[model samples]
Target: MQPIVHPVVGYVCYAVYARWADGTPPASSPAAVAVVAATLPDLLDQPLYHAGITPVGRTIGHSLLFAVPLVALVWLVARRRGQSRLAVAFAIGYGSHIAADVPWHVLAGDYHELGFLLWPVTPMPAYSGVKTLGTVGGLEVTTLWLEAVIFVGGVALWWADGRPGLDLLGRRFDL
Candidate 1:
């Protein structure tokens, strides 16, 4: 899967979370948290990996080591503070990122890579620091099936996000 696909997955998960849990659209503060949490792993992982701080993009940041405890902590705090919905919304997006990434490598028979999902408790292999984001630029040519899924999910997200969250520009970035 590509990087763009991750966030699209996040958005789709946001919609799913709303429909299944909240009955409200994934919007307002929760939507804001979801969007950021979705992309956070890559945002923190890449530059660190690129700079040789870690051997792989899947580090503590991408691991259950980080996510489980963080989400638990957030859930606990949110419940105490009466913000459980926000915590659940963020967890949906954050967890969906890892869920989506796991299959992308697993289907290719990279079993050892699975440890990255639970890291520290499981060992990690070196990830050659190479940029993969460029792969997304050739969307139509390289990843026809994946791109199609992204397109459909994007359309769904547009509808589910209440269809002009795009007015963010005119609304002066309400998100």
Candidate 2:
């Protein structure tokens, strides 16, 4: 999945969870956390891989080895601070990111890409070359279209939910 899609998925997931849990729209702080957490895996792994610090772009950061423990720690800390909702939001974002990366290859019976989930227990596949954007034309045209659709839908939903985090940014930037 592309980086842009991750945060949209995170926001949508958190919005759904918030409504289901409390019949309320997501608050700014948690919404922001969700967006950042959604990009955490890539933020950690991509730089490391590009630096040649890791063999693949999806190694330790993408592994359950990292996510499970980190999320548990966040939950523990947040619960103590009476901010468990934030932890839940983070988990929703992070977990959705990992899940999003899996389905496409799995549905195609390409299990080799899944080695990232195990990290040291299993070797991740080498970096695949980048895919061209839909406008430019490539094998990933369908993926780009799907991402675009999801982004548009997510934006509409966010707007319908009163644009939870926008006010926070506006206040900070005086926009």
Model 2 per-residue lDDT at 167: 82
Predicted structure with the largest lDDT when compared to the true one: 2
lDDT of 2 at 117: 90
Q: List the residue pairs that clash in candidate 1.
A: none
User: Per-residue alpha-carbon lDDT of model 1 for 21-54, expressed as tens digits?
Assistant: 7686666567666766788888888898899988
Clashing pairs in 2: none
Candidate 2's C-alpha runs over 4 A off are 127-141
What is the C-alpha local distance difference test score of each model?
0.71, 0.85
Model 2: per-residue Cα lDDT over 1-175, one tens digit each: 7888888888999999999998998998898888889899999999998999998889877999999999999999999999988999999989988988886566545678789898979888874533333454435555566778989998898889888878889999999
TM-score of each: 0.76, 0.88
Error of 2 at 125 (Å): 0.8
Per-candidate count of clashing residue pairs (backbone under 3 Å):
0, 0
| Global CA lDDT computed for model 1 | 0.71
Off by over 4 Å in 1: 126-144, 164-175
